[model samples]
Target: MIFNSDTSSDQVQSEFKGRVSLLESDVKQKNCSIIINDLKEWDSGTYQLRVITLPRAGSSVWGKRSCPLRGYCNTLVEGEISAEAGLCVVIPCSFTVPDRIQISHIVWFKCESTKWRCDHGDMIFNSDTSSDQVQSEFKGRVSLLESDVNQKNCSIIINDLKESDSGEYQLRVIGLQMEDALTFSQKATVAVKGLSQRPTVMIPTLTEGQQTTLTCTAPGLCSGSEPTFTWRWRRRGESDTDLTGNITAVKTENVASFAKRSSSTLSFSPSAEHHGTNITCTVLFQGNVSTEETATLNVTYVKEVRITQNASVSEGETLNLTCKVDSFPPSLITWTKVSDHSSRNGTGTTLQNNTFSDSAQLREERGTATLSLFNVTAGDAGQYVCTVTHMNSTWKENVNVTVIYMRDPVITGNLRVKEGAVLNLTCRDNSFPPSHVAWTQVFDQSSRNGAGTTLQKNTFTTGDYLENLRFLVVALLLLMIISVIVVNLRYWRKSVQQGPTNTKSPSGFSNEPESLQDYDDVSNATARAPTSPNLLDDHTSEGEVEMNFPQVRFTATPRRQTTNRDSSSSHQDES
Candidate 1:
C-alpha cells in the first residue's frame, strides 16, 4: 500500500498490517484481487479498488482501477407487456453490467409448461449460435433489437403473437468475464389477447345432393387453453341446429409474421331443403370472451318437379294444369301442348300441322306455373309438357289429356211385322271409350236386360234371313183368309134374300134349309177363327195367339169332328 509521502512510515505500516487481505497477489503475471468481509448496510455506496503491478525487470510500477462494487447483480426492470393475437409486442428492459465483464451472447426463454419441462423452458434465442435450438412453439417468432443488443439493451420485440404466448419470460445475458463465462436472468410477463381479433368463416359454392365441407378459422393460432368451437345452422322453415365439427391446432412462422391459427371443419350433404340458410361458427377462448362469424349458404339445387292436375277430364271442359318447381333463386317454366290437326285458311285449303298452336293461356307465380285451356275439345287431346329451367340444367315432364264423348243410340231395323212373322231390330251408338248397351221391351218389364260391351258400335238380329220371308207369307195369307170369309158370307146372304118359307115336300122332307130353326141348330157349331200355320220352328217365337171360329173351317184339325148335320163341302181351308 502507498500512502502520502509525509505520513509516518510506522503509522502507514501499522494501518495496513492485518487490515486487508490481498488474494492471489502475483505481481509478475499482473494478477489483482481484493475482498471485503462482514459488510453492513452502511457500506452500501460506491467503493473502488486499485492495484499496482511491477515488471520482473524492475519496470516502473503501473496502477489500474476496478469497477465499483454494487449491492447485487445486474437488474432489469419489467412491467407487463400486452399484445394482440395476430399483432406483435415489445418487452422493454435494461441492465447495468460491471465494466470488467465482457458480453459474449444473449438468450431468451419462456416457461409455463406442465407436461415435459423444456430445457431452459423453451429456448427463445441464443446469440452465440446463429441458429440455436429453440422450442417448436417459439422458433422464428422472437427477435432481439440488433442495434441496442451490444449496449446492454436486453429488450426484445416478438412478432406474430398468439394466445399461447401469454406467459412469463426471462432474458439471459451470456458473456465472458476474464476467462470464465457467466449468465444473468431478467424475467418479464406477457399478456396476449384472444378476443381482439375476430374469426373468419369462408363460404363455398354448394350444390344440391352433393357432399361438401366448410371451414371456419378462429382468431388466435394457438391458445393458452384449448378453445372450443361450436357450429350452428338455420334451415329453411325449421329451427336452428347444432353441428359437430373437427378442430385443428396450427402453429406457423415466416419472415413477415408468426402465429397459431385454429380452425374447424364441417362436412354434410346438401339438398333443396337446405336452401337459403345462415351458418354460424363461434370460438370460445380461454376467458369468457368469444369470437363468432356468420355466413349465408347459397346452395345451388333443383328439386324434383310435381304437377297438380286432374288425370281424366271430360270433353268441352276447361283444363287447368299446374307445374311446381322448388329450387334456389327462381326457375323458369314453359307449358306446351302437342296435337295432330289440320287447319284451313281463307283459301279453303287444309294446312298440315301436328302440334297445337299457342291457343292456351299461361300463368306463373313464385315456383309454379299453370296452363289453362278454355273450352277444350277433341282437337285439344294430346300430351302436354312442362319445361323447367334452373341453373344450367333443364327438365321436362309430360301429361296426357284425352277427349271423349258418347253419341245417341240409333235404331235401324224393321218396326212392324204381321202375326207369326219374325221381327228384326238393332240399336247402335258411336262413342269414344264406349258406353254400356242394353235392350228393353215396351210391354214386359222383366224382358229388359243390359247386354253388350263397350265396343263403339253393335248390331242385333241381322243373321235371321227367314224372318223376312215369314213376314211376306203372313201378309199374303191374311188376304186369302179375308177373301174366303167374304165369299161365304155373300153366298149365304143371297140365299137368304130369296125369302123362302118352311114347307112340306114329297117324301115328307122340309127343303127350306130344314126349317130355319133346324138350320140354326146345325150352324151352331163352335165358331173357329182362321189361323196361319207355323212356318219356322228354329226361329225364335216372341209370343203366341189363338182364334175361335167353328163355322169358318179354318182350323187344320177341328176341336170337335163331325158335328150332327155338318156340311163337308168346304174342303178348301183358310191358308
Candidate 2:
C-alpha cells in the first residue's frame, strides 16, 4: 500500500504501529496513492511508492509502482460574501476534500493576523499562548451557517455587524485527532454604511395678492459635495419652469464618507397663476441621486378701498367737498368746480389758503384734494363739480348750491281802546329788506265841515313826542274819569254818614230869611222846598197874631206875659 500528501510536510508514518517509522530509502515514483489504518491529518504527509522483489520472477519485478505525488492540497474553498449594516453577513464557504480526510468540526474566527491561531470547535476562543477563551465584542455575533458540521462547509453568518465588525474573517476545520486539525481560512472585509435617504416635501400652492416661500431638503445619506439645489414651479396643467429668484443650499460633513446632508430654501412672490404649482429640489451624488419633495403655495389678501362726500350744500355758506378713491396705492382725487354759465376747459384753481371766497374763481384740485369755499356769497352759489381722477379714470360729483333769503317779518295782535279816548296808533311792517312805516288819522264829514277846522296832513313819525302824546291823552282821559267817579262817590257817602241836624249846607246857600225868601220867590213861591230845614226856637205864642192896617196912627200894643202864656196854653189846649 502507498500514500501521498501534496503541499504539506514530507513524512511517512504508520498509524497501526502507534509510532512514526521512518522509511529506509526515499520513494521515487510519481502518481502514487497511500492507504493506512486510522488515517489522521498528521499522517497526511507526503509518501512514495517502492517495489522490492522476493525471488519469484526475481529480476526487479515492478508492476506499475506509483511515484510520490507532487501536487498542492487545497482544504480551503473559495468563499462569497454579502452583507448589510445592522443586519447579517453571510460568508459562504464550502469545501471538497480527498475521501481519506474526514471533517470532524468546523469553526469561525475573526481574522486578526496570519501569525495568530484560535480554537476552532470549542465555545471559547484560544489565542497563541494564553487562551482568551472568548471574544467579548464578537461572542454572540458569530454564528455557523449550517447546523450540520459533517458537511465540512464551514460557512459563517455574523448578525448585527457593528462599525468595529468591519474587519476580516476566517474559517477553520478540525479532524478526529489533534494532529488532524487544519485551518482553512478566508478573509471577508465588511463595510457598514448608514441608511439610504431621508424624507422630503411635496407640491406648492398660492393665491392672488399674496407672498409665498417654498423649500425642499435633500435626503439623509449624502456627503462631501454640496447637493445641487433647484427650484422649479410647475403650474397646474402646465410644464415646470425654473425659478429665477433667490436660492440657497448647504451641506455639512460627518464621520462616514456618505453622511447626513440636506439642501433647502427657494423663495418667491407668487400670484394666483402659481396655484397648484409644483416646487422641487434635486440632490445628486456619486452613486445615487435624491429629490426633495414638492409643495403647493396658498396666499391671501388684506382689504381694499371704496368712495366719499355730502352731496348737497346751501349757498352763502361754506361748502366742504371731498373725493375718495379705492386702491392699494391710494387713488388720486381731482376736484373741479364748474359753473353752468362758464366755458372754462378745466377748473385749475388751487386753494393755497384752503378757502374759496365769493370773488375767487371756482377751480379743481388734483390727487386727493379737497374743495372748500370760505365766506361764500349769493353770486358764488352755483353748481360745483368735483371730479375725482383715479387709476386713469374720473368720477364726478355734481353739487347744487341753493341761495337762501331771509323771509319777511309779520306783526300780530289787535289794538285795544275805549270810546272818546285819544289814542296813539303804531304801524309795523315786516320785510326781507326792512320797509318804512307811516301813520295817518281820517276825520269824519262832521269834523271836516267845521268852520275853523282846517284839513291838514301830518307825516306820522315813530318814537316822536306827537306819537307819545296820543298815548298820553288816552291815558289821561282814563285817569280823569276814574278821579271824577271817585270824588262823586266819596261826597255822596259823606253826606249819608252825617246826621240830619249835623248835615252842613251845600255851597251857594245863605242863612238869612230875607235871602231865602228872595231865592224862594225867584225860583217859585208857590212850590214847596225840595228839602226841609229844622229850626229850633220856642219864643212865639201858639195863637195867631192879628196885624193892624198899614200902620196909620196905630200904636203897637204890649200885652202882659201871663196873659200870653194863658193864651198860648189855651191855644195849645184847643190845638
TM-score of each: 0.42, 0.22
Clash count, predicted structure 2: 23
Q: Assess candidate 2 and give its TM-score to the true structure.
A: 0.22
Which digits, one per residue and each the tens of the lDDT, describe model 1 over residues 1-575?
42222234455444334434332232322223333333347546564555443353422343121122351144342345566665455665555565666677767778763422324647787665565477776666666656445587666666556788888766555556444333343356688865455666666678877777777766533323445777888876777785433233332222222224466777777666566778888877543567788788888877889999875677777888899998876898877655443212212211112233455566779889877776777766777777899978899888887767677889988898899999877778877677766653332322344333322222323333367778779878876875565444333432332323324345333344422232233323233322345321233222221323432322121123354214321322211
Q: Give lDDT: candidate 1, residue 37.
A: 33
Indicate the residue-level lDDT of 556 in model 2: 18
Candidate 2: lDDT over CA atoms?
A: 0.44
Error of 2 at 31 (Å): 42
Poorest 10 consecutive residues by lDDT, candidate 1: 343-352
Model 2 C-alpha lDDT per residue in residues 307-400, reported as the tens digit of each score:
2444344445665665444332244454444565452565543243345445343333323445566555555555655554444555666656
- Off by more than 4 A, model 1: 1-197, 220-226, 237-240, 244-257, 341-359, 390-394, 404-575
lDDT, model 1:
0.56
